[model samples]
Target: MLYKELVELYKRLEKTTLKTLKTKFVSDFLKSVEKPELLEVIPYLILGKVFPDWDERELGIGEKLLIKAVSMATGINSEEIENSVRDTGDLGESIALALNKRKQKSFFSQPLTIERVYNTLVKIAEASGAGSQDRKLKYLANLFMDASPDEGKYLARTVLGIMRTGVAEGLLRDALADAFKVRVELVERAYMLTSDFGFVAKVAKLEGDEGLAKVKIQVGKPIKPMLAQMAANVREALVEMGGEAEFEIKYDGARVQVHKNGNKVLIYSRRLENVTKSIPEVVERVKEALKPEKVIVEGELVAVEETGRPRPFQYVLRRFRRKYNIEEMIEKIPLELNLFDILYVDGQNMIDTPFMERRKVLESVVNSNEWIKSAENLITKSPEEAEAFYHKALDLGHEGLMAKRLDSTYEPGNRGKKWLKIKPTMENLDLVVLGAEWGEGRRSGVLSSFLLGAYDPVKGDFVPVGKVGSGFTDEDLVEFTKMLKPLIKKEHGKEVELEPKVVIEVAYQEIQKSPKYESGFALRFPRYIALREDKGPEDADTVQRLAELYQFQERLKGGR
Candidate 1:
């Protein structure tokens, strides 16, 4: 199909706000697609993506690189293109405007097709190492050379994946259901299993519901790992999970999905990126220990000290980042795997298997050893038993416990009440440093009085709670000064705004209502615990979270 035809669909989709109309627009487009191969990738393309999310290759095209390509195609100077981008906030429109001024087109340029555009992008992503930048630039320039001003608008967005398609996953799912006469639930389930809507669309288009039903787990492709909803404590978790729960230790390390297909093992991180080459030791451990020929298991991969206690979560992250001399790092920080859930075993689809039955399958298949074993767990209705297990996990250097419903099926990418995270909360909170003031008296040259803020995920910014100056040694003050100097955004006398990049755990006496900050809560007697290098600002405590924690504290006091 012509790329311009999809561009017209984008124009129409952008012009509507009604869901039914938008769904029909996408549904009609799907029906109009003639080739099955085009059907296979059009869904992804409509989402402004060259490949599925599970496919790890990025386009390797940045704003600067894209601007250079635009400049090359239109003979527009880089300066004017950048100014046009600043004037018009959209990257694609800026490139299109620049292309509109082209005096003439290339002699050999041809009209762009969806397949050609997609294939050229695949080549750009595949380009790497030693003149790869030049190659990627050439591929992009060649496409922009042929793209019309209208086609250039979408082409620019497609390469950078910033297209404003009205069709989201839900809309596309609905459209596929409408276009193919398949159940939405079936389409969704098939999407969850495959993680590729295009593939599911193709299957649904050709084979209908019967083919969708046959969509099952593939040993090598990483299924989205199940996530957990946060519970304040074990009591709340037990109450939420229906009084009796299959609780397991939640280690303070990386969660990995292990896929084994006889003599081969691949490990994926929580984000579903393949990390097989980073942790060969893990692959070796899985190959040696797992008895099943074809199976996929989910587990916590923790970096361990020599005494078998789990190290800090960041220790495992170091291994993940190391691209060179991995063998040395593997020995330097050995890892321990605690298998918790099994998704598939041999040829059987174990996702729909109940939680307790899946646990049994995991225990039955593994040759349990010290470093790699079934996670420590307890099945109980008693609060005392659950609390004891929670404390035991913390005592063993774990973060918390995961309370799972006994009969809950493993739902990929779903964080529902079927599974919950139980972690003990204190008056202390993890906060990001929003800004700081220069120290006075005995420490005159450092950012000592730190203005701290709690992360509000909804706002996507930090909301101030209070300022802390107490809990740091002189050495810490100097080190923090050195660290924060580079991230200063603005300065006014001794006070300076920061980029909210640094996270620290702050202890407080109580959370009190106040109008001093935007969050309307203040931490009394706030003191620093330590820099939380393992966490980012996104991982910091939330404003609503603090409000909820304060309410919980109030309820406990009222009961007393």
Candidate 2:
């Protein structure tokens, strides 16, 4: 597939909002995609070569390369290319302009197909030179060589670490569903079950769209959670809900989902990345806590303080830092797995069942020992009572409460109102941790500040919206380094790619527009609250909401 073909498809998908129409459009195109390489490139074209979890990165392509490429394509002087690219903050646009000036007509035209795109991606993903620098450069060069003009443009942006693909996971899911002639829910189900788009395509081919719908929850499939924020106190949450809700004390700990299959135990973070190796001690605790032959239990891993009370998220993070001496660290900062929701037991997929029934089954399967215990929860009809419970949680030094709807099915990765969060003033908006800068001065050894973002529904990607650096202690900084070190994938300019699993509450003075951050926004005086163990990436506030908040703040300022 030529780069132009992919761009044309992207252009079409970009215009449509309806999923049904999107599916039809995609299916129509898929019928013609005979090339296998095109199939492979679709993932990289849409998603990118690196998985969301990688964090470590090198500097992006230098200006020198941009100038050379621009000159080669346009017959322009290096100085001209440098000035244009630097002023625009976009190397791709510079290349595009140069190419256009050189030729009045299209120089290369080819149709995009599954085969061509897929082959290009395979090359990009597998490109590795002798050293790390060589590997990165080779990857960039292969991308330019294989991708069409448009593909090369975007591919260059990705290599430069500029992910300006406004389309988001939800929007992309809709597009995939449209392209495959399946329902959005079905496509999402297949994605959650397999986490493989290629697998999804195959299933869509064999069983058709409905086959995608029949995807069942299996032992190894980790479902995303329906997340909520805490309403002031539990009392406020009750008041807001007008008396109908269930309240559970939010634990200050590492969130974990333990899948026990007889003797084998696999633990995954909320983002569905396998973290079995990171928490060896937690694995042992789950083993002793549950006797189930096969089960998936979702819960928190809280670090107990000296007073036997669970400490903040920092303590739990410390246990992950070490590759060696893990046994001693596990003994030192031993964690308690606080089970809350259960999705499966034995061989049955219980997610389709109501919460009440699932909770009963969860209670029956696990022994409520201190190290591996069920989290406390209360069902109430009165908002007043729920609010009172909220107070009790904060008074106990716990984060507010997680109020879940009793009748709603667990819709993985969707933020339905079924699950509402109520937190203290300290816990405000959950900002996606975008990029972390090296700590300065006293905190020179670790990451101290994080560039954060909110989801932009229209763009379909997280938009840089804020930053938080004030609330964490030195202890928290050290702990975060241990936890965040491995999740790094690519580093470009001031941005990064991290597994969207970790969500943190941040308090900001205000929001403002800025050119420095790709998000075109910035936060004023932001501080940390807590690690949101209950919230998923999809649950984070949208960019639209952030814009609204900013506008509202402006209104207040004008009134004052």
Candidate 3:
């Protein structure tokens, strides 16, 4: 397919708000592809991403770099391009305007295809070390030189990692299911197994439903981690789990999926980005401890003090995001592995195995040691026993307790009463920062006021909840400036639009219905607790979860 054809499709999808029609449009388009390789690029490009969500390599091109690229393409100055961006409040719109108003036409230009554009962007992402930015600039400038005004708009958005077209991952799943005439449930299951929509779509189109059913866990590929919903208290957690539950310590650290095939040990974070290079000690520990030659397990990587006490959660972030001097940093902030679940062992897939049986397998395959061992857990039918277990976890500087049903199967990416998180306090939401405003008074020149958003799983987008400016120390304000200033995509007056990558935990007194936000809800007296560096925007609280919390708050009010 041609790049212009895809851009035309984007324009059509933008004209309507109904998702059913949009999904149909994409479904019909998918049936017209001439090449199978295009299948892998089409889904991600439609979402304005250069790579899959799980891939770690990014375009690295930001607003200023894009300004330079646009200027070189249109013969406009950087100052003029920046001013146009300010006027339009969108970089894509500014690029469109600049391309349409170009003084000279390129006589050597030819139509760009989807493959050409996708390949060029991949090269831009892969370029590294000395003069790599220049390499990226030349490639982007060439794309702009050939793009139509409409194509230029999307190209700019694509480089920045957002399409702004209101398309979500769920819609793509629906379209893939419809395009191949496969059962939607089967398609969803295949997706959960691989975490890659392109591969699932290809298998469905080529081998049909039977092939999807045969989808098995691969040792190297990371599956989406199964999630847990919050419970009000110990009694509620116990009741939801059929009067008996396995309570495990929930450490305040990064969750990792460890894959071991022979001596090669790979670790992926909660968001599925590979982190094996940062934590070399984990690889060594896995090498020494595991008896099986091939297996995949889930665990927590917590930073520990010299006394073996767990460090604050932020200390773990440095190791996860490590880029340089890894050996030195590893010794300074040590980490311990806490295994919780097993998904596969040897040649067998264990995701469908009952929890108690899977635990037995997990224990049987491993040689427990100080560096690598199973998590501390308890099986109890009494509420008092569970409460005491929860208190013990909290007293040990852990987060809380995780309640898992003994007979349930692991459902990737599913959150419900099957697994519940029991914390000490009422509740705190893990939200993403959508935007931020410049600080006022003594805190001037920093981004202080944050606009918070919650994820809506059905719509596959973020909805505004409220803003928070209090509960931040002066040091926090300085750190915010360093982290958020480069992520500014657009600015108008005192407010700026961010890239929506930063996640933070928020404490709020109440939830109320309000028309001020897109979700028709707002948080009352919301304040910051801490930055969530281990989580991504997609892992934040969902709108459905917030509505449930709101109803619970109302019941408390009535009882009072």
Q: What is the C-alpha local distance difference test score of candidate 2?
A: 0.64
Global CA lDDT computed for model 1: 0.84
For lDDT, candidate 2 versus 3, the one ahead is 3
lDDT values for all models: 0.84, 0.64, 0.86
Tens-digit lDDT track of model 2 for 240-336: 5555666788887767777888878888766565667768877877887886899988998788866777787777666644557877877788777
Model 1 sits at a Cα RMSD from the real structure of 7.0
lDDT tens string, model 3, 1-560? 79998998888887886788888988888888767778878888887787765576778898889989888888988899788876776778888999998766679998989999999999999999999999999999999989989999999888876576667778888898898898888888888888787788788788788988888888888898898877777898899999999999999888889999998988888878778888898899898888899999999989999888899777877898788899999889989999999999999989999999999899887799987899999999999999998999998999999999999899998887788988876578999898999988998988999999998766557889999988899899899887876457778789988877789989988888999999889999999989887677767888998987887667545642
Better of 2 and 3 by TM-score: 3
Model 3 lDDT vs. the true structure? 0.86
Better of 1 and 2 by lDDT: 1
lDDT of 1 at 144: 89
- Name the weakest run of 10 consecutive residues (lDDT summed) in model 3: 551-560
TM per candidate comes to 0.75, 0.65, 0.90
Residue 449 deviation, candidate 1, in Å? Answer: 18
Candidate 2 deviant stretches above 4 angstroms: 1-45, 50-167, 192-195, 229-236, 239-244, 382-388, 432-452, 461-505, 509-524, 528-540, 544-560
Candidate maximizing lDDT: 3
